[model samples]
Target: MPARTPWIRTFLCRSDNIGVLMRDPETGACAAIDVPEAAPVLAALKETGWTLTDILVTHRHADHVEGIPEVKRATGAKVTAPAKAGAAVPEVDVTVSEGDTVSVGALAGEVWETPGHCADHVSYVFAEAGVVFAGDTLFTLGCGRVLEGPPETLWRSLSRFLPLPDETQIYSGHDYVGSNARFALAADPDNARLKARAEEAQRAAAEGRFLIPSSLGEEKATNPFLRAGDPALAQGVGLAPGSEAERVFVALRAWKNRF
Candidate 1:
């Protein structure tokens, strides 16, 4: 557990993407993980009455950085992005790499270079806070596409999360849980746990609820991409039982590409 309590607020933007506001209870310091748009982010800051202190950008995609300039103008927050991104994102006050540290008031977190979703993509994990801003690299029941790398690189990036404590909470870049759940069920049809989750995800979407903040533990069980090494997953995808983990992983990504 964190020395200071961590407060996270999740909201949607552009009808699909997930935007977040993080506050450190001890210092009243706040940060936005990725800004899909500005209206809701501004509104959340207003509602919480917390002054923004920083912008932690996960990737250089337009949807992630499109609202950065506007939000920065409004909050005057310092912006940090992947060092490799260079000029890809606007107004980077700090460019960080694999081992960089990000601080919010007295609270701090580590940078993780996750470039498979796109070259120079990154994610942040405040281990003490027990949370991660996964950006587009990972989601509830799915992961990002291989736009900039092969399945092997993505597998390595995704594998980084497996060693984290099960209690770590995941905040994703988008609200694609419903569709990911459908694809998971298709590939791993006999997974009763997945069957139950698919129905739950469908019901939640039907009721218009946000499904972005799932735990790493839940993802271990429900995300087939994460379970690609399991013999069961290999067979589910019609691979021979002893096929390599990367093979199952590559096949899974291919199936998701068409999903």
Candidate 2:
């Protein structure tokens, strides 16, 4: 891993979508993680005075890929999308799969095929920078709904993140901490760490500051989805004690869907 960290700028886009601009300070090579909208992205570029060199697409969702055409036309940046997305996403200049590396100047991010939110979903882990752009696969307190895959599939995808360093910065696609906190509390009410986190979420909301870039360590400690392996969580979800982690995860996901 590189010793230097990339300069990161996080902003909101299109309602609740979290937009990120990651730049390598050494070379001024900047990448937009996903384009929720073009106007704000272009404005951010102008505001920061950093030229966009790449658009690292996370999935084929309309909200994520809608701004690609406009942004690409404006900056001529190379667009890299998931190979599994095929033609579902537009204006793709390159396609990447698992183990592929994407470079933004001096920084490199490894591509992980993390489906479950959708069959084409992927995540970008900049190990050198200790950050992961976790599309819709994983979120702050909750995880993405299993829209295109089974709950087990989604759990498997989430498992991929567990092995990262505790300090790894996690950048998810949306700012759903408010709603997610409610569900998390319902599912894991007795968790002291979760209670504290929920209060912090409230404080962040009051200040208009989002908890977008959460740490992997914090998620492990408090996120109900990540803690599904705990026997207590299985009991909370009405499952018998000692239920498999995957089963507990399915129960939690189902409850969240209705919650």
* Top TM-score hit: 2
User: Evaluated with lDDT, which candidate comes out highest?
Assistant: 2
lDDT of 2 at 220: 96
Pairs clashing in candidate 2? none
TM-score of 2: 0.98
**Per-residue lDDT value at 110 in model 1:** 94
lDDT tens digits by residue: candidate 1, 1-259: 5455588898888889998999988888899997889899999999989899999999999998899999999999999999888798998999999979999876788999987889889999888888989999999999999999787898899999999988789999999997899899988888888888888898888888866788898889889999998888999778998998889999999988988
Candidate 1 residue runs with Cα over 4 Å from true position: 1-3
Residue pairs whose backbone atoms clash in candidate 1: none
TM per candidate: 0.97, 0.98
Q: On a 0 to 100 scale, what is the lDDT of residue 83 in model 1?
A: 89
CA RMSD for every model?
1.1, 1.1
Q: Write the per-residue lDDT of candidate 2 for residues 39-141, one digit (tens) a residue.
A: 8899999999999999999999999989999999999999999999999888999999999999999898999999999999999999988999998999999
